[model samples]
Target chain A: MSLQRLAIAACLLPGLVACVNSTVDQMVFNTPGAGIGDASVVILGRRHASDYETEPEFIRCVGNHISSRDKSIGVVGEQEFLDALYPWFEPRTAPLRPADLERLLEHRDVARAFTTMQTRYMIWIDGSTVRNDSAGSMTCGIGPGGAGCFGFGTWSNDANYEATIWDFSKRAEVGRISTTASGQSYMPAVVVPIPIIAPVQGTACDSIGDQLLEFLSAEY
Target chain B: MSGSMTIGPDRWLAATLLVFLLAGCGTKQVLVQSEFPPPVMNKLPLTIGVWYDEEFANHEFFDEAAGRAETSWLVNTGQAQVQLWDTLLKGMFRDVVYMNGKPGPGQMNPVVDAVLLPAVDELQYAIPAHTNVKVYEIWMRYRLQLVTTGGAPIADWTMPAYGKTPTAFMQSDEGAVRLAAIVALRDAGAHFASTFTSIPDVAQWLASLPRAGDAARRRVQP
Candidate 1:
């Protein structure tokens, strides 16, 4: 398919399959006069919470989306960055604020990494997708003659996430972007079950990715 | 119908078979290892001696809550711990020397400022069972002692670390445990790097050392 057809198909995919609605909000404290050039952006998923963790797939989804949209944007791989820094950026030890980043830069090796990676923007993403309000169920069993599932099922999923952008050169949070998305999925079984699954998390990731690309690459 | 039903030879045989299948019966040996990254810190201005005792070097734990013949998990952590601590200590100190025979300051082959000892005080692990949450968790506590050459204690630090799989949907039991252990080890390293100087005795010992050019960098003179 041509780029135009691909774009058209992407636009119409959700309408044909499932419904996903998402909203993006951004607050800019300080904007860089010059856009990000050679400097890299590291998007890390926050995994410190006791009960839940931000999925790694979601972080990669956001990174891939932004990089695909704009090739010039230097988006560092999450695991590579984490391993290079190792214990410093682990779940329990990561700096909670930009001031903490200042403290981390005090270390000689960490400072060297800042220069080596040319990391200018640090995006910390924290949130998770949750499923609730499931109202139906499908039952499957095997009898003497044949085996099949029969029932109707539905559930609601909500994906809410917030991304804090830290300008490493300035040692302060420049802005934050948050996305909220929710969708309902259904499954109906006469003999075989058909699922109309919603991609709420993907919708949220794309929403945040677009806003981030515009923030870092597009002329405002 | 009563929930408690009578059991006979056939039912007993069936229950035993079912339990064996569910538990993945017998012994499972697992090796827990991790690749430690170099800490980003200026080395302390001290040459420390590290002694890895025999038991500490070959430590492994066997977990058996279902009696001796049933489910048993044998996890070996000695080699990984030694490698991790060795790498970590190298990052934290200017020079490190291995000690032989647990020698005191009076007559040691390779003499240093102080001797360091690290041991696992306790370790515990859990896997998803009879629950909706598919999670694997591990917890470890470490005992670290910094002592003078004469064996007088300088600082005794005990710290805890924890790790768990984010989602254990399709991972095997052994794989999940190994991953969690790696996370816990990294957590311990992070804590040690960031919190070592905060110990009162260690702070005092560090204060005793003469100025090493820039105090912020903690760089020792050659």
Candidate 2:
């Protein structure tokens, strides 16, 4: 009985080690040069919580995103336009200066989270705009040519995803990333999950993030 | 919101004002600080250049269909896209030094050092110092495109969009087209000094040097 017990213990140890190694690997894999340990990932956008009526699949995908990673990713949306988009989105906009966007990035806490062990990464999704043909705006619904059109009653469509990463310590643009897609009206529009890892020529948000992480991690 | 203030030796001529053209039109302007200058002896020279590290050649625009278009479009039509990108680059070197409470002692507009630095390379500022006092040298080069609907060649009106009457489409704001030019002395002033040292030697410092911002700041103040 004692010999049998020892054999079982030896068999289980490797599996446990593999689990531990896998967790660490995933963390390191997600962020190539992220200063090791847990890094806080903050997703700032107009939408936060999932909406079944409007974006059911998106809502489901967000839940899957949160569960996949051990790090925390919070959403903020205090601006007038942002408040209306997400259910749990917390609205936040820095005191923007008149000089330039570079100056605007200098505002403390705009990108970096100093208190936590993790660093702060911000993603800004552009706000949606209404479509009106008379004033030269995009249409809300379908057109006679089978193209997308927007009427007065419909809400404005969302802007492309433009993610800009900043290092609080450096106080300069460490990484800036943006995303956009085209199709007829909103039908053609699609929002991919964050940390898009495609290595293709186009539609590669993950690759952009990966490259930025690599640069930040590189020893100068 | 539109607002203006009068400033200058000839107060009547000075219509210093700011007006917001449009919101979310992919353009913005902000006040660094509020302070008046003595008088305009000369306008500051704006230095514009694509640093060796920056990817200027393979530059691309935002394709409505492409996901990566936003990154290209923003950088392309960015603040640097305008003629003023050079001006602001030069302006950063002008008045304030790091941690100093006052603007540089010499003329703020036309810094002698900026006028001299561009002479080192063709990619640097090409124009010689202007002879006139009021008119500043506006040396500008920008990437642009003339997009038109498919049509026959017409000396007078080649495109259908250009009917008998001229329209706004004729004056396209296509990707960084005509970035623009302006002659004015702008200073972020002493408040911004804490973040910078002094504008150091422009030519000597290679792009490879680390903490170059610190080096530049140390040399900026006279």
Q: Which numbered prediction scores highest in TM-score against the true structure? A: 1
Taking the tens digit of each residue's C-alpha lDDT, what string does model 1 give over A1-220? 8999977865764455579889899998876666798899999999888667788889999999888888888899998898788667998889898888877766778788879999999999999888889998789986547778999999998999999999998888999999999999988776666677888998999999988887888553
Error of 1 at A170 (Å): 1.6
Which of the CAPRI classes, incorrect, acceptable, medium or high, describes model 1? acceptable
Sorted into a CAPRI-style docking class, model 2 comes out as incorrect
Q: Which stretches of candidate 2 lie over 4 Å from their true place?
A: A1-36, A46-114, A127-159, A185-220, B1-222
TM-score of 2: 0.22
Residue-pair clashes, model 2: 25
Residues A1-220 of candidate 2: C-alpha lDDT, one tens digit per residue = 6999977855754343100000001112133353423444344433221110112123223223442432233322223212221111221122122123344333232223234324344333322211222222234443335443432221222223344554433444444444432211211121211111111212223333343344333321
Q: What is the lDDT of candidate 1?
A: 0.82
Q: What is the DockQ of the complex in model 2?
A: 0.02
